[model samples]
Target: MKKLLLFVCTLCWLLPPAQAQTGTYKGIGTIVFEAGAPLSLIKGTSESANGLINLETGKFSFDVPITSFQFLNSLMQERFNDKYMKSSRYHKATFVGRIIDKGPVSAKGEAKVTAAGILTIHGVARKRTIEGTLVQKGNNWQLITAFPVELSDHHIQAPRLSSGYGASTMNVSLRMPLSPTDPDPQQIVAVKKFGFR
Candidate 1:
């Protein structure tokens, strides 16, 4: 009986904590943005946004290829990539951060959450606090967030009248459906390098 009890205690001590047993989720999602112009809103979207979230630690990372964004007007898309965003020089925009709120998310309904992270755009990184909602359905989770980006903050020049483009700010929205899975090794390394662990 003494030996059995000792074995059980040892086994329990070797096991990981419940909080450390949470799964990581990774998936590709849709990202959309809108900018105000003189006559109409410039709307664009991309289905190539990739994201990873570790529920146990609340660490998350998201990235989207700048050239993947599509616009209603091909010329506008070209201008956005070449002249405005300079996608050739800065191929992608990324965000890495962790959730700051406490309490476990209830599976029954939407839960409001806030995340503070670094948002990198146009080769510049800025710290931002974003608020969003999380909803659980079956074995997957859905996260949605909307935030505004100022042109000046990232050193992106405002559109010029002669260029027939004018947008001072861009409203960005992200909708991601994340499912539990083993994360890519490279992605894990990148996330750790960003200090999210």
Candidate 2:
């Protein structure tokens, strides 16, 4: 009985049971930065969307959560919700694109790819290019994107710098964990027709 109990305890310690990642998942991400400074201006991720990651073909389809934009502080959040972003009308900012560089992520340590496509924000679709880097350890993948998107590109009127802030492109950061999902664009968002714009 003591031996059995010891074995059970050892198993529990060895494996972090619930912390393991899942297949066919929904990930939440944040975009934190100012147009020219570091501020949590935009934050959003999909609670429900297709996440079929084709490491082989360097293709992907995803939906950016429409209702997840929160401001840096409570004050900013209120201001953004009420005035700047007007989250109620212009819900989500979505993107649909494919990785340009294809490689066998069959086994990986560090891999980099460039994803260029369209970003629709506040009812406007504009061209954008962002670099994606992934660090894979076992079945888990850590992804990161370092890129800049100009607010003017999407026609986000910058508040006067004298009273507001000085910035043109809003710096963006995206991190997500890949999961097992269907490889179909039917439920997947269309780069040309996604309604998140």
Candidate 3:
């Protein structure tokens, strides 16, 4: 019995640690932003947002390809990518941070949460504390948040259109459904390539 107990203890010690509960958002996630334009609202959207959250540690990271955003008018889109965002140089915007109110999220109700992290856009990184709602849906969690981003904060200049001037601030919203699973290897590689942990 002593020998058996010793063997069991050694086995447990040598075994690898259990993987943390992680949720990955891919493909289906959406990010929308609207800014006040000269005559109307400048709205854009992207469905290529990707990210992952580790529930156990409250660590999370999200990436958005700058060129993926689409505008209604082709000319507007070109100007946005070329002049405003400089998508050719920046390529992507990313956020890496932790959820402050860490706890088990229940499926029955929504929990208000705050994420404190660094948001990188147009090659500028800024610390931000964003508030959002988290709700469990079946085996997944949905994150919804809306925040205002000042163009000047990231060194982004508001477009000087012929009609007038664009808004200095834009409203950005995100709706992401995260599946409880390990992130794909390719996604991990991509994140690493972009210097995100």
Best by lDDT: 1
lDDT of 1 by residue, 1-197 (tens): 99999998788557544212245778899999987754677788999999988766788999999999999989889988998899999999999999887334555656677899999999999999999887776557788889999989999977654347667889999999987675443333222222222
RMSD, one per candidate, in order: 6.4, 11.4, 7.3
Best by TM-score: 1
Error of 3 at 138 (Å): 1.2
lDDT of 2 by residue, 1-197 (tens): 99999998777557542222122233445555455433423432333432444554445665555456554357655665556656688876777777776333434466766787777877789877777776665545556676777777877765434336545666676777764344242333322121101
Lowest-sum lDDT 10-residue window in model 1? 188-197
Q: Model 3 over residues 1-197: C-alpha lDDT tens digits?
A: 99999998788556432212223433258999987754677888999888777654568899999999999989989989999999999999999998876333445646677899999999999999999887766546688889999999899989765567767898999999877675443322222221112
Off by over 4 Å in 3: 1-28, 37-39, 102-107, 161-163, 183-197
- The local lDDT score (0 to 100) that residue 170 gets in candidate 2 is 64
Considering summed lDDT, which 10 consecutive residues are worst modelled in model 2?
Answer: 188-197
lDDT of 3: 0.76
Return the candidate ranking by TM-score, descending.
1, 3, 2
Clashing pairs in 3: none
